[model samples]
Target: MTYTGDVQVGGPADVRELPALTICKLAVGPYDNNAYLLSCSETEESLLIDAAADSDRLLALMAERPAGAIVTTHQHGDHWQALEQVVKVTGAQVLAHPLDAPALPVPVDRTVEHGDTITFGAITLEVIHLRGHTPGSIALLYDGGPAGSHLFTGDSLFPGGVGNTWKDPERFTQLYTDVVERVFDRLPDETWVYPGHGKDTTLGVERPALPQWKTRGW
Candidate 1:
């Protein structure tokens, strides 16, 4: 998850190297959402995570690289603000959890649940269902081999705490429990976390604050 420089709206940060992939993080749209391009180094095919916003910008970032699909991390409006345009222009298939499919602007080409894995070239992304951030909120995990795993968390988990729960205590509880048991506890500390917005963080750093969030009732 270590990176340098900032990706202004319509631009991409320096590429990050992983075991079999190259990751480019772009800050796009009015919301400053983070759109990720995870490319398989061997095949050059990439998966766009959370088309968030700015079709022109996102498109420019992709350039001539072939994109396999546009995967919606959750149902939140901001996360998919530019989804329709991205899909239309790139001709990439759309995938999402059934619970959040109805919230998308276009029909989902594929519906995925926990334990399902999507493959593009030599890389495979395993889905992890995380509720509360959105009813069908999900994360993608790429086994990084010796480098640990890569986690794409869509507004479910973040650097300092879990995503905003809209003041719903029940939602907060659900998200917290899922994150703790499904994420921090199950994954190794070296896991890299890429969120829907802002900077990325590692699970090792975020693991210790679980108690604080629970105690604060956020």
Candidate 2:
């Protein structure tokens, strides 16, 4: 089946294949958080993004490869409900931004900041810190060159608008600025966005709406 980036809790994962990595996106937990299991095509080593929930299912998906690390995108409780169990089973190193590390269920093995690179097998993902959603909310960027780039945006961004700032103007501005400068301004429009919840979208599809999102002050 073609990759649609559509997934639901208890439903099958949506897989996207690139030159160096294979991304499997699954939704888990009561909050319907998306967990991405990324496997390197060359070494078969994997890295999981957000062990949100359903330890059994997440483990089953990692059966074929060695899970190297689990990255918690932020400090949100909903995003790490299954984290402890998953870490116990896989022994995957826990990675998160230093600002949010203390809040995660498991202690972070390494605290990452913007411009940092995480490597497992031959795949490397650059970290992009997107503040405001949480002080340390982050997005991982994988540049596939001609195939375009893939951004794993956890709560900092979504299809139609940026993450909810609870109507706080300062918070909204902070998130919007980082998203526009660190993300939209830096990456190409062809970048595929894999958000922490719901379906995916591309920068090209969302660029025109940036102004609208800012105007609404969300």
Q: Which candidate is the best by TM-score?
A: 2
Residue-by-residue lDDT tens digits, candidate 1, 1-218 = 56752566656565788778998888887988988888988989999999898888778878867577989999989989989988888889999999999999999999999989999989999999989988999999999798679899989988899988998999999999999988988998889888888778899998888899999977
Q: Candidate 2, residues 1-218: lDDT per residue as tens digits?
A: 78999998999999988888999999986899999999999999999999888999999989987588999999999899989999998899999999999999887999999999999998899999999999999999998888789999999999999998999999999999999999999998889999999999999999999999999998
Stretches of candidate 1 exceeding 4 Å from the true structure = none
Candidate 1 has which clashing residue pairs, if any? none
TM-score for all models, in order of appearance: 0.95, 0.98
Model 2 score (lDDT): 0.93
Clashes of each: 0, 0
Each candidate's lDDT (Cα)?
0.88, 0.93
Measured with C-alpha atoms, the lDDT of residue 18 in candidate 2 is 86
Q: Least lDDT summed over 10 consecutive residues: which range in candidate 2?
A: 59-68
Error of 1 at 88 (Å): 1.3
In angstroms, the error of model 1 at 112 is 0.6
